[model samples]
Target: MNLAEEIQKRRTFGIISHPDAGKTTLTEKLLLFGGAIKTAGAVKSNKIDRHATSDFMEIEKQRGISVATSVMGFNYKDVKINLLDTPGHQDFAEDTYRTLTAVDSVVMVIDCVKGVEIQTEKLMEVCRMRNTPVMVFINKLDREGQDPYDLLDEIEEKLNIQVHPMSWPIGMGKSFQGVYSLYEKKLLLFQASKQKLDDTDTISIENVNDPILNDLLGQSSAAKLREDVELVDGVYSDLDLNAYKNGEVAPVFFGSAVNNFGVRELLDCFINIAPPPLDRETELRQINPTENKFSGFVFKIHANMDPKHRNRIAFVRVCAGIFQRGQNYHHVRLDKNFRFSNATAFMAQSKEIIDEAFPGDIVGLYDTGNLKIGDTLSEGEKGMYKGIPSFSPEIFREVINMDAMKTKQLEKGLMQLMDEGVAQLFTYEMGSRKVVGTVGALQFEVIQHRLKHEYNATCRFAPINLYKACWISSENKKKMDEFVDSKYRHIAQDKDGKRVFMAETKAWLQMVQDNFPEINYHFTSEF
Candidate 1:
């Protein structure tokens, strides 16, 4: 296919929610329905012998939580899909935030019982800020959960997004019969024989009063379904595709992801209404997907994807034109041309070395300590893709190497994990002490686990008494030098070698800001 045709035929999005809301399960079902996998491998539950394909890391498999993002692409009904299943825990918000930038839209999975949780609200904030289109999936319909109307209200109130249900549930918990797809104007019955991601039992229903529903769902369920559909039609407007695309409204669906019930309705409607690869904003100007020149940016970098090799992969979302293997692209940060001999496109467990990829595709470029998060690669364009940033960490701990003999391993692992952008690595200027900073306390545990297992390096974290880590800068070379020289002991260099002021307390930070009016204190590294 030609560039425009190829770009138009792709839908790239991320699946996000609070941990255990069935986000990962929904992702698996999508892949299963897309023909990317057969018979679903495993699940997020730890008791399962095998695990979900998206949770590839050993730690993830063991903990039953995703600590990193997994990019999976597949072809469904002639439309290419790039699905990024991100870590739902708040500890990995940085990774999830960056993944949002890499996709054109999002599929937010919310547990029917829990409604909108903390992490779900936070993820929605990111989507709202980016104006990324979102589709809500109220999962776990097989279990007794909240009232659908209440859940929708909570989603709207907590997430601050208007929603229109494209599919209404037949009933709640055991009473659940199925969902009626408003998008397709069809009634999908959750039949035992049709319990598979790829298939569902459906009957064309031009009218909700169809008698077949009464026979299929029984009197009570059919009556409930009829009442719900009438209320939906009366209270809610139709799924405004334009409004959804603009991120002003979301199309909601009801289903039980674990039972493979009501997923096909989500997928079929998704392919028809969800957006294709859209335009991206770079530092210089907006770049259209149909642009002839290739431009992409690195949003995530994973270390040790394959346990057999120490291979690091940089996940780049192509923003425009085409990216061809063996073709040199300008690395905006490094200011050099780099070519990839082995670039991959993910499909759950399989990594296909594709010859070329169009816009909206996430291409995994194998790297050896060259690319970092937010680095842009383009057709020799100097301007970078904007908005990816490293947040100032809340918790800081001094990392002391226990295994002196494995110092190299420790350093390599630390640097690599820092490059992954889950946490920030800082070196104290006075004692050369290594400090790891993270947004959430859980990241410390994750870092510790990965270091010992993946790097075979042993290290202990010492509590560093500090309030915040602030990146400092100044146009006045003399003022900056003086400030750094005076506070050398409290100064640290970040992963990118940018000087950060390690404030011991809130008062100390305020005093420093008051003292040095010329120096700028930044919470995020993007500035």
Candidate 2:
């Protein structure tokens, strides 16, 4: 197959949801159906052992949670699908933000029972801010959970997004037989199967007629489907389900990903209904490399696992024009230029050498040293894009240096960890140097375990708030100065014989406004 043609017809989306809402399982099945992998790997089993294929980190495998974003691609119906599997945990929400910056759309996965949660809301907000289209998956319906209808209602009420059911599960929980695609108005059933990441022998899609599905197709249900379809059709012509005589939105295929059920139908939905990247709106943002010229954003950076290569890989999204291999691209922030010798398109961990990539494609460039998150690659004069948002570490804990052994090694390891997009590191110089590891509190145990296993560094965590302080200029600074007696404001001389105003926040604001009336004062938060 012509991979570039398929990529031209591709739809790039991120798989996102609350932790353990079956986001990863959905990702595995999509990859399997698309033929990127043969057998879908279970998150619990860690069976395929495709290290760094997606969540290619030791900490992810050991803790059974995704700590960073995983990029993978596959093909369905000759159209390419590039999917980003992001960490669903609130602690690693920053990873999701970076992943969202490059994608055209989102697949918001929700647990049938848990419905909407904190991370789900956060992810939704990011999507909304970007105006990215969304397709929701109420996963795990086969599990013993709440009614799918009730869950749908919750989604509509909470998410403030239209809940258009493309597929309806035949059963709930363990009994989930299959799904009815409302759009195609087809009933898809799955058969038992298993294969490896490279093997392609699992699940197949077939048309089926079950009384449950038939009943859903009856007059009463048909009427409801019509109402829903009209509501959807009236709002967006893109969803013209009226084309389906069955008056359905689309077909919903069901099966247990853990059991390898209903995988094929889901794949069919992606090929049949998901919007291609070219079909989606192009994101217009300020580029550091100049608007009249070409530039791209580095979505991720990774070190090749192969010891021989031992080089850093920079994953970039070309926002405009074509980027060629063996050419120098100005690194705007580094104030330097570097040449990319080998550029290749990626399928998970696999690489296919490619000469060039254009806007809307994600490709990897090799041997770019000192690449960090949010770095822009451009041709022509260097400028800064509105920088990618920095993730604020929510929880803070000091890393106590024990044995004073390998403290330098510990610092070096921490610096390397920062590159992995895992957690932020802060160092404090006490009698002994204290390293503070900041992450979502849920990640503390995992961090400790990794430190013991990966770094072989013994450390203790001290509780801290990571508090930030903010103040109003008028109330705090202006008032303090107005209230301070003039005698206390007598000119204070510094060693340089220069006068300095040793004033509180309130006094500083008052002095600035009184002395410099034309200047406007602004309040800032101190972290």
Q: What are the TM-scores, per candidate, against the unseen true structure?
A: 0.97, 0.73
What is the C-alpha local distance difference test score of candidate 1? 0.88
| lDDT per residue as tens, model 1, 169-245 | 88778777778888788887765423244343667888878788778888888888888888889998767789999
Local error of candidate 1 at 31, Å? 0.7
Backbone clash numbers for all candidates listed: 0, 27
lDDT of 2 by residue, 166-208 (tens): 5556556655555555555655455334443322422222333
Q: What are the Cα lDDT values of the candidates? A: 0.88, 0.60
